[model samples]
Target: MRGNRGAHRGSPDSGSVTDVVVVGGGQAGLAVGYHLRRQGLDFVILDAEAGPGGAWQHMWASLRLFSPADHSSLPGRLMPIQSGHTYPDAAHVVDYLADYEKRYDLPVQHGTRAEAVHRDGDRLLVEADSGAWRAKAVISAAGTWSRPFVPALPGRGVFAGRQLHTVNYRRPADFAGQRVIVVGGGNSGAQIAADLALDGDVDVTWTTQRPPRFLADDIDGRALFDAATARRRALDAGRDDTGGVASLGDIVAVPPVREARDSGRLKASPMFERLDRDGVRWADGTRASADAVIWCTGFRPALTHLAPLGLRGRRGHITTVGTRAADEPRLHLLGYGDWTGPASATLIGVGRPARDAAREIADLLDA
Candidate 1:
């Protein structure tokens, strides 16, 4: 029976075929899987993680969702949180994802890293570490966790201080008593700088290309998600969506960040001109000494696996109309960012696009 199933599914060894293959088992992937399951389509979710939680497993120890637990849930299930836990922590998110997968019985192959995706005649070939899957359609929901973007600043190599990206950041204790520079203007930078500067034990400097933007104190992730949805809907209806509004870049006023602000520790400095042996150098020839630098510079999409398809645009992303790849009709991308779908990277934002993408795939298959 095992051999028969393998043969039927077109295992990399046997060249079997499946109906669809969704890459990455993160929030985006899981959302898409839910839709596909509801459509009664044959599909499999390929995740590289050894266990559940997708990229949440790699988040810093103190990371917390900016949205409430109920608002941050994936499709079909609300993320369960303990009583009195308003904002779910990283562990809660991970556990919720694991339970979601189990609850839906989504065909997710854990630890199956998709190395490459290429065309195999009319079908798409997903080359994974465990094996290969041939599918009529492919949804690349692999979010950006694998590709941390560190800008190529001048003299970066000469910096003697330790440099780490947000992906490598785990805890504040790691930089205890050290003078650290937190780079970038995003929430990660704010939260991390606050974490390290807590109790005034660590000297932390925040740097940004532009002054960071903070949302109104009353606003949070739920409001931001709603705004993004409205913008997407307006644009989809051929209406102008250029009206001024708070963007996703605006930092949410989370408790820790608020506390940091009240304590006068959430200050930021203009970006330095370059990195020096000891620290960062300004254009005015002044240099600040630093023991380490943490880059909260965000990530690029993990699309190397799709390179063989030749579908990516000059922006290093595939041009997509909604979730469908413009160049490769059978290929779709979800949850990378707004380009794939509005606010698709967030847990609250992925569902609509995933559902639409699944429906399109089902329609195509039917045709």
Candidate 2:
């Protein structure tokens, strides 16, 4: 509906405007950009990062994808794989994302952080660090990296030991020779626990609300993604197809985890009742002197930018029909996970929702 206004970087006082403003430069935003490019929509992608490779650049050094490069790619291009590399590390993913942005010539403005989104008559106003953007529609793909969620426990603040979330964890070397507790039942907790246990000198204990479930050795992220896709398709077709499928939450027994299991270091304890001044206290009144705690809890969607619109529900999520916001048709949310779209948070899974959102926005503007 709007003509192309070639890329430029400056303050919002310049009156920068577009038909669509995609509020992130990560996989979901990039995927949506690809479709918008095909639709010939005038749009700009805003990224807060200093350069390419959105949040992937912040991942832990030892972290690796559970799937191969090809299976973990975005919509248009295949993520190139190096010879003999089964699972790509964070650096590889970062490189691929950077290349994807360049290859598509996506109009992405770096260092532009969206602070708020509100309706201004027929247009949506995005207030960002660089300035303001008045867009016909706004796609909020800001993602969950900024909103790490750590559940509260009794005496949490009284514990003398150091506490950090997975967001701050980079490598196992930092906890060397320390008695550490890794908390969470998810894959992150399993991976981090295994990594820390690899160091013979580090005493690592794992705590989970429930026992962690590990998928069979043959199953990895690829299989999990495929199964999720199939289940979604089946549901759309009015059939239940998840009878025997393993959830994405189940841990894939990557090499390190398998090694940890064989070494009997993969064991996890029931979650401690409370944190004590010196350590953690169990239900049976037993206390372990932990030097540090690592919370592998997941993240909440980073939707603060949309608060001004007053669209959030009780769960802090805006209700969406597919990727389009239920309350605000001109506003769409991407990569906020299952509520927005199935597997929307993963690299390979975001493409479908991105495509759908782009098409929906295109239709709305064309009308």
Candidate 3:
């Protein structure tokens, strides 16, 4: 993964009994941090990265928010208005986050990567690379991208060329004048291939196991909203319904990759069966040549250190909508499950739950 600790003030070391310790410094983590600050609670944000912007700063340089600025700003801050009413790029987001941290004088402990969080008697013990902390509670804002999920295809290491995940992607020039096979048709693969094609240097080919069902607008909004509401109601009534969050295809608008495909820029191919010195082999016996393969496959929750928290359901994701483990009350999860209303993993959606979580944490500290 690509990260930058650039231009920081100091190292993150523990010195006090922080009321609550946040385990990440991304948009979600910062949201909870800001709220806890307003509550005048003794807290600190622990980020594995050395700087801000979380994963956004590490995205390909050409990346921009799919949602408009009006739909993506964090709490108490406005996204910078630009001409032409276009979406902001990666750098723009990084700058906005930096400004947010500075404006609020958010007491963030940067460069302190959380190692483990466990209960110690009546308090929580937060261990990090730099130091350890004692807190009354912990906000698990480590995000869905905490761990990059690289699938095990036969002969991955046998391929004799550069291989990179979207998380490691930086700029198009790195692969300039090369034939690239980008795996996965998610937003990242589509956008990255589009940007590379636009750069007029890299020839891009994309692959996906199955084409996602795309929407032009929020056409599927009603059905997806109904599903989320149903799940939320069941949870609120103290029932555990594992299918709270709608699938990605259900919520996100179709990525702009179709435009590239129509223009004959990005060639869509079947999923990879195996990799070799020449290129990728498909299930249909088709072979393609490439110099690099970008795996935009996706990520999983990095809860290795948190295995003791007892996450239920499949993939270790919290099964209950908007509810922490009844057994692990000290573990408050942000961006874990889908909420029926304005509370989802999206930046716009994360606010209400973040507030609710911050208050819950505050109460735990008060006790």
TM-score of each: 0.95, 0.95, 0.83
Residue-wise C-alpha lDDT for candidate 3, range 245-266, written one tens digit per residue: 3443622442345565557776
Candidates 1 and 3 compared by TM-score, better number: 1
Local distance difference test scores for all models = 0.86, 0.88, 0.70
For model 1, what is the alpha-carbon lDDT of residue 269? 93
TM-score of 3: 0.83
Error of 1 at 295 (Å): 0.6
Worst 10 residues of 1 by lDDT: 1-10
lDDT of 1 at 107: 76
Cα error, residue 134 of model 1, in Å, equals 1.0
User: Model 2 Cα displacement at 203 (Å)?
Assistant: 0.6
